[model samples]
Target chain A: MSDASELPVGIADVEAAAVRIRDQAVRTPLLGSAALDARAGGRVLLKAETLQRTGSFKFRGAYNLISALDPAERDRGVVAFSSGNHAQGVAHAASLLGWASTVVMPADAPPLKIERTRAFGATVVTYDRATESREEIAAALAARTGAVTVPPYDHSMIMAGQGTVGLELAAQAAERELVPDQVLVPCGGGGLTAGIATALADRLPRAVVRPVEPAGYDDTTRSLAAGERVANAAGASSICDALLAPTPGELTFAVNAALAGPGLVVDDDQVRAAVRWAFEELKLAVEPGGAVALAAVLAGVADTADRVSVVVLSGGNTDARWLT
Target chain B: MSDASELPVGIADVEAAAVRIRDQAVRTPLLGSAALDARAGGRVLLKAETLQRTGSFKFRGAYNLISALDPAERDRGVVAFSSGNHAQGVAHAASLLGWASTVVMPADAPPLKIERTRAFGATVVTYDRATESREEIAAALAARTGAVTVPPYDHSMIMAGQGTVGLELAAQAAERELVPDQVLVPCGGGGLTAGIATALADRLPRAVVRPVEPAGYDDTTRSLAAGERVANAAGASSICDALLAPTPGELTFAVNAALAGPGLVVDDDQVRAAVRWAFEELKLAVEPGGAVALAAVLAGVADTADRVSVVVLSGGNTDARWLT
Candidate 1:
């Protein structure tokens, strides 16, 4: 196990990020449903980031990263790449801080996300997921316009920002006299899992942090198993567009590999079922990518028996028609 | 204009009920959405009772009333009459407290509610909403089974329980350093409205509490205006099945008439739009009746400009098909 001092993000950094985003980002509720508890045959607490600003936990990292930049850097603007949730988060956070933002998004991202990103006053550049690389597009844009590139997860500051979710979750759970045995976080580039794992290490050391991903995009799971970064097969696709990251981030993987428990993977059908379950049972709208952790829990992939479990519903930016 | 002592439900009662139900019921969050705030042109806080146990604030009242019963009364079982939400609440609460429950529900009530009520281990008796009187049916059932009748919102204990929503909201808002100028509640029998109004009278003296209802079922509005109970036209209908109480409850109106502000009404289309907006923007699965207050706010009928408004999303018990 890596020492806390060696991790890219630490509890102290998460604490600082919490202070920075305290006034700007929402403290989304840690919700519980008796129906869900019965289904899991144990207590289940949901960290509803779907209720977070920009309808995702991405705002925490985005705001933390942007707010820390100097005035000169802020004036130069920022660029980010995401399937949907992070784009909206960056757009909204940058707009709130009076900085222009440009996002490189998948061409087939849910229309609602694209529209909301634009509505936040960010210039959106759509790129084909199969052929074009979003990183190249964002890097080229940043290089051409002299804008700062705000990576989705890799940075220490970004991981610290996302770690606030874990900070809040641990505190909220403690308030309710709950000691969670495990926390399931949706893994994209593994930033959320790594951040949460680091926070949990400080707040609730006994609580295991597990990364959950869609089956085809289970690079984080494979990477963790191999004890090294492993890329997903090229042309792999799933309904969870947001979690289609090629591999775990180098920084995030370093932290997650040391702190996180074994990763969990769910299929598209399980994700769809979880989305429906969230709507019907939890009364929350969760997108396919956001529902992977929930899918793992509902699919009996997560061993929730005789334990208090926290499942993070990461985002809610899907089209209404998809829910129907 | 009502004094704290004069109200049937008071802050003290709500406080006591909050303590009683503290461990049993979920203390739902007071959520704020920037998107919703921008649309209202001011701050908008949502008291998400849709996240409450049994998917509505009804569980608070039901649990409070059922838990307070004597051992003999508990053994005799409990009976309740509701369009849907109250039935599920009473059923679930009674089941949790080891008491048998029977609910009189509208025959046309959402199938989801009916199914969930059964799932909660309640015996459900259905009556034609347009023809049969639910009160009479529940009374008969209670008479036959010697079960204690737990009226949805009429009783003092029930009102006290529902008032806890306001108690929590006030505290939550205070935590966020927000002093709400107005609170909008979706009114059916006025229990929730009266309870909230009474709580706010003590906690937030300057905040105006307004009852919002569907246009055709604006009995609470008319009742407050005329200083007497006003019944809706026979056979009146709207998509808001849960808010179709023929007239305001006598006990609830007595408290509301003095404590609540003038009522607000929204048409079915406005309500439908609010439900869709909740799904799209707020990411909450609010039923039509629960969306009435939100509809009033979204339709520009609530005067949200330059003031902090709290809208109560009362329930989430509609069929998924209806959301589509």
Candidate 2:
């Protein structure tokens, strides 16, 4: 295990990133999860990034990345590749920052999110997921226009941006004298987890940070075990579509590998149950992807050890059709 | 119409109430209504009381009521009658204040709410709505034991408690340097509408306050027109079952008569659409009764009037089974 001092995400980076994106984003609330805590055998504090603009935490990293651009690079515009939340974040951030944007999304992306991205005055480039990847299309666009590519994760700016969540969590908790013993964070490309781990490693050096992944796609665990990035095998299954990344990011994996414990996988049933739990108990209509950590805790994936825990409800943008 | 100086609720009361309840209840977010604002030709802010503790603003009043009790009355415990949110509120408030509570609820109350009430350590006294009125049972219980009865509405203490929500709105808006031109409040027994009106009547004296009711049970509107208390025809007719009260409270009606305009009613379809709109657009799972004001806006029950408006989303305890 790497020493806490060596971690790339530090308190200073989180504070600086917070300053950079302070006026550009909303400071979402960190609320108490009494019902979940009762069920999960420890206190649970939820970082409600779902209430963030564009209904996701992607705004943090997106705005963080875009805000760091030089005057020249910002004028050149920015491009991002995402099928959902990140696309909206890039579009919204670019629009607010007065920079033009292009979002490359899959043809199968939800129409509502697509509509929102377009409404934010970003050009929407669609690709057939069966043939071309969104990254490929975004790269091509970036090269053609010299627009900075603001990736969802795997970049210093994005990691630092994501770190602000931890920064906010630290500040909010300090106000109430709450220092959680464990924090279960949902992992996709590991930007959120990496950023959080880096930011909190010092203040909460002993607080265990667990990365939670969907059962069928436990690449973070596998990668962490092997000390490198790992890709999922062919034909995995999951109901958490937002967490369906095929592999872990190289930069993010290294950071998480240094600080994070072994990742845990929660099944579709638990994800569905957590989705319903969030609706009933938390009164939040979070998507399956956002409920994975809460699902893991409720499903008894975490060793409570009679300690208080915090779970980050990363986003809440689920399609209405999914509920139907 | 009553002059601003004569209103019971004032800027000072709201500030004091906010300080009193700051730690006890959630400071539910003020959600911006972009679409609703566009349609209303003005800005709309939603005071999310639906996100309040116990899933309703009732908790605010209940908390204040319990706290206001003399030590002697508090030691004797408390009793309340309700089939819904008030039961939970009384139960939760009693628990918070370290007082014993007995709640008399209609036998037909939703099973989940009943279970939640029971889980909160409040004694449950189930009554047959077909054979016995809950009020009679609660009054008997209070008489038999000398336990104080906290009426859901129509009481000065409860009204002051509910007024705290309006107090919060004024404080939050002032922090942002914005004041609403109009406020739309959901009406059942009229406690919430009257309380909010009382809270804001002084500072924003010219701000129009409109009370919204379910279509088939528009007692507040009728009572206002008749200049007397008006009762609804027996039985529930709208999906907003929580708002299907037989009559408006005498206390609330008197307050609303002075501060509010002619009332508006929304149909069942509008309630469901507002519920759907809340779920889809706002990412909040507000109950049907809680969505009534937004329902009015969506159904165009009120004239736009080109004034910035605020809607109270009063509660969020929807049946979990209903969402699926």
Each model's DockQ?
Answer: 0.71, 0.44
TM-scores, one per candidate: 0.97, 0.88
Candidate 2 pairs with clashing backbones: B9-B198, B50-B315
TM-score of chain A of each: 0.98, 0.95
Task: List the lowest-lDDT window of 10 residues for candidate 1 chain B.
Answer: B1-10
lDDT of 1 by residue, B36-141 (tens): 9899999999999999988899999999988888866677899998888999999999999999998888888888899999998999998897688888988888
- On TM-score, the leading prediction is 1
Candidate 2 to native Cα RMSD, angstroms: 3.6
The deviation in Å at residue A240 for candidate 2 is: 1.4
In Å, residue A180's CA in model 1 sits off its true spot by 1.8
True contacts kept of 1: 0.74
| Per-model i-RMS | 1.4, 2.8
lDDT of 1 at B124: 91
| lDDT by residue (tens digit), candidate 2, A149-253 | 988888878888988888788777786798888888998888899888887886688787888999879999888888888799878867676677889887788
Q: List the residue pairs that clash in candidate 1.
A: none
